[model samples]
Target: MSRIVYVNGRYLPYAQAGVHVEDRGFQFADGVYEVCEVRGGALVDEGPHLARLGRSLAELAIPEPMSMAALAHVMRETVRRNRVRDGLL
Candidate 1:
């Protein structure tokens, strides 16, 4: 199966993934991200990770790219597509 990556509200083939060169996350290292562990198709420490993300965003005064619910959806979908039973996001 072709790898799918979520980028700017769309999931695309990994080989086709691209981000605007000017996006602050890429250009200025201005962003907050969370990495959660996945096991048996379920996210571990998700709530804490999200809470930390929120804190980081608040501390940096950077707006969240999407709502928590939206991010959760994306994370789950990415894991599902990757068929990852155990991994990190």
Candidate 2:
């Protein structure tokens, strides 16, 4: 299966993933990210990770790209698509 990456609001093939050079996240490093450890199809240390994401975004004065629920859903979907049961995402 081809790898899918979430960029902007769409999931695209890895080979096609692209971000505009002017995007703030790329140009000014104005973004926050969280990595949830996947274990047995579940996320580990999720709460703390989300908390940190929120804090980082707040500190950077950038609103979250999506809601926590949406972010969680996307994270799980990405992991599932990649067939990653034990990994950091």
Best by TM-score: 1
Worst 10 residues of 1 by lDDT: 26-35
- TM-scores of the models, in the order given: 0.91, 0.87
- Give the TM-score (vs. native) of candidate 2: 0.87
Candidate 2, residues 1-89, lDDT tens digits: the string is 89888888888899999989999888987676667899997889877888898889899899888997798888888888888878889
lDDT score for candidate 1 against the true structure: 0.90
Q: How far is candidate 2 from the true structure (C-alpha RMSD, Å)?
A: 1.4
Candidate 2 off by > 4 Å = none
| Model 2 error, position 36 (Å) | 1.6
The candidate 2 region of ten consecutive residues with least summed lDDT is: 28-37
lDDT of the candidates, in the order given: 0.90, 0.85
- Model 1 misplaced regions, further than 4 Å: none
Error of 1 at 32 (Å): 2.1
lDDT of 2 at 53: 89
Compose the digit string of candidate 1's lDDT tens values, residues 1-89.
Answer: 88889998998989999989989888888877678999999999888888899899999999988898789889999999988899899
